[model samples]
Target: MTCHICNTPSNESFQVKVLFKYDVTYYRCHECGFIQTESPYWLPEAYASAITSLDIGLVSRNVRWAPTVEAMIRKWFQPEGPFLDYGGGYGLFVRMMRDRGFPFIRQDQYCENLFAKHFDVTDQPAGKTYELVTAFEVFEHLADPVATVGEMLRAGKSILFTTKVLPNPNVTPETWWYFIPETGQHVALYSLESLHRLANRFGLQLYSDQHDLHLMTAKPINPTWFRWFTHPRKVALYNYLHSYPAKSLLDHDFQAVSDSVRKQPLKDLI
Candidate 1:
C-alpha cells in the first residue's frame, strides 16, 4: 500500500477484526509516519449513523471548542465574511458558533443539517469564498489527505481541524484506542511528522496543541490570543460570559464588559 499523505510504499503493520467480521489490515508508512487501514469496504456501515455511538462527547466537544474557535476568528479574520463548518455533522458546531454571534454556515455531504438547516452552504451561490473554515474531527476519516486538504484550501485560505496526533512512535495499532476498527470510520492516523509533511506540501504554517486541535494557515497566527483561548477554563468562561443577556440601551455597558474581559492579561489564564 502507498501512504495516503506521501506516495511512499507502506508495509502492513497489523490487522484488526472489525465488526467481528472483516479482517482490516493496517499499514504504516515509514516515510511519513502515517497509518491507514486498507480499502475501508465497510465505510457505509460505519457511517450509517453519522454521529457514531463512540462519539458521545460530540456536544461537549463543540461546547468546549466553540469559544476557542470564536477567539480565533476574532484574532485572525474580519467580522463580516462567511465562516464555514465543513464536515459539520448535524450542524451542531455551526449552531454553537452562531449562538456566539459568529456568522457560521454548515457543509456536510453525509449528515443531516438538523440544527442549522437554514445555514447550509447549499443556500449560497456557487463560487462563494469564505473568511475561514472549521473542520473539527474530520481529518482522520480522509482516504486522501492531500487531495481533501486541497479541496478545503480551494474553499478558503485557512482550515482549523481536529484529529488527535499519534503521540508515541512505539505505540502500535493494537494499543492505540484511536484505531477503533468497530466503527471503521477513522482510516488515517497521523503523527506530528505526518502533519509537518502536510504543512510543507501545502505551504501552510502549522499550529498545533500537540494533541487533537490543529491549524494550517497561509498567514501567521496570534500567539497571545491563541494562549488565551486554548485553555478549557478560559474557553468555558468566554462562552459563559458571552451568554449574558444585554438590553439595547446597555449595549455600551456590555461592550465595556467584553473589552475588559478580552483585555485581561494572559497571566491570569495560568
Candidate 2:
C-alpha cells in the first residue's frame, strides 16, 4: 500500500496477532511516518454494529474526563452559536452542551437517528460552516487523515480534536496491544511534529497537551492558559485544581469554571 499522507511506498514493518484466522499486518512509510493496515483484512462487518451497541454507562464514563476537556475547549475556542460534534458517538458531548443550554448538532456514520447531518470526511456540504467542530478520539481510525482534516476545516470556523498519540518510535507487534487487529482502525500514528505539519499545511494553529490530547484552532489565536501560566509550580497548581476527579469539591469547582468560561464571547477572540 502507498503512504496515505505523502504517497510514498509503504513496507511491511510489523504484525499484530489476534484470534485464530485474524492476524493483522501493518506497513510503515519512512518518508512521512504514516502507518496503516495492509489490505485484504480491514474492518469487520460487525464493527459498526459493535460501536452502536456500546453501553451508555460505559460511554458516560468516557466523559468523566469532560471537565478537563471542557477547560481545554474554553481556553482555545470561544463557544459561539452552533457547534458540530463530528463523529459524535452516542451524542454525549452534544447532550452535555445541550444540558448547559448550548445549541449543537451531532453526526455519526453508523447510526442515522442520532445524527443531524450524515456526511463523511470526503462528503461534507460546501459553504456550510460552523463556529466549532470537535472530533474526540476519532482521527486514529481514519484511512486518510489529511483528507479528513481538510474536510473538517472546511466545515468549521475552528476545530478541536483529540486522539491517542504514539509516544515511541520503535514499532513492534506486541507494543500495539491497545489497537484491534480486525478493525483496520488506529492506522495512523501522530507525533507532535507531524501533527503540526499537517495543521500548518491548512493554516491551523495547533496546541497539544502531548500527554494524550491535541487541540487546534483555525486562526492565530492562542489560549490564555498557554500564555499566562508558565511557571511549573503555577501550572501544576492550575492542573491540580482543574484535574479530572472521580468525585469531590475540586470536580464541582472545575465544572463551575467551565460553565463560566463557556459563557464568554467567542467573537472577541476570533
Candidate 3:
C-alpha cells in the first residue's frame, strides 16, 4: 500500500497484537520513514470510545505541557488572537488557556466538550482564521495525516503539536509505549526526519525538541530560542516566578454565561 504522507509504496515492517485481540501488520514507508498500520479496519471497534480508558496520563500531561506552551505562545505568537485546541479532550486545555487570558477554543470531532461549555469551533463563525493551532498527542491517532494537516494549515499558518518520535534502533514491540497496543488508536508513527518531510510538504519550517513537542510555522525561529522556549523545568520556574498574562477571564466568563442563560427561552433553560 502507499504511504499516506508521500504516496510511495510501503513495505511490511512488523506485526503486533492490538487491543489484546486482533493481529495487526504495520508498514514502513521507504521514502518518508513513516510507519502505518495496514488499513485499520479495526478502528470502528477501537474508537467505540474517543478517549480510551488506557489514557491515564491525560490530566497530568495537560498540566505539565501547559506552562511550556504558555511561555512559547507568549514568546512567539500573539497572546490575544483566537487559538484552537485541535483534538482537545474534554475541553480541559482550552479552559486552562482561557483562564490564562488567551482566547482559545476547543475543536474535537469525537470527544464530548465536558469542561468548557460554549467554547468550541462549531460555536465560532465559519471561515474564521486562527493565530495558531495546537494539537497535542493527536498525531499518532490520525488516520489520514496529509488531509488532516492540510485542514489545519488552512485554519492557521502555525501549528504546535506533539507526537513521540521513533528513536534510533527503535525499540522492541514490548518497549515501544508509542505503539499503544491496547487502545489500537495509534495507527501511525513518525521519526524526526519524517516530521521534517511533513513540514516541508507545506513549505513550513519545523522545529522540534527532538522528542515529542514540535512547531511548524511560516515565521523564522532560531533553533536555540525554540529549544529554550520549550524547556519544561525552566518554563515551570518562570511561571512560578512571574504573573502570567496578568489577567484571568474568571468574572468575564461568569458574566457571559449568565447573559446567555438569561437570553435563552425559559423552556429551553429547563
Q: Which tens-of-lDDT digit does each residue in 1-270 have in candidate 2?
A: 887666679888877754335566778777656577765344555354635332345355445444444444445554444567787776666666544434456777754434222223324455667777888777776777889888887778577777756666555546754355544455676656667767777777787766455666766655556533333455546656654431222344357547766887998437
Cα lDDT tens digits for candidate 3, 1-270: 898888899988889999989999988887878889988889888988999888998998888788877877777888887898999989999888888887888999878998787889998999789999999999999989988999998888899999999885444477777898889999989988889988989999899999998999988888887787677788876666655545777678779889999999999988
TM-score of 2: 0.69
Q: What is the C-alpha lDDT of each candidate?
A: 0.82, 0.60, 0.86
Best by lDDT: 3
Q: Choose 1 or 3, whichever is better by lDDT.
A: 3
Candidate 1 accuracy as lDDT: 0.82
- How good is model 3 by TM-score? 0.94
Order by lDDT, highest first: 3, 1, 2
Where does model 2 exceed 4 Å of error?
Answer: 17-23, 44-46, 50-62, 112-127, 221-270
How do all the candidates rank in terms of TM-score, highest first?
Answer: 3, 1, 2
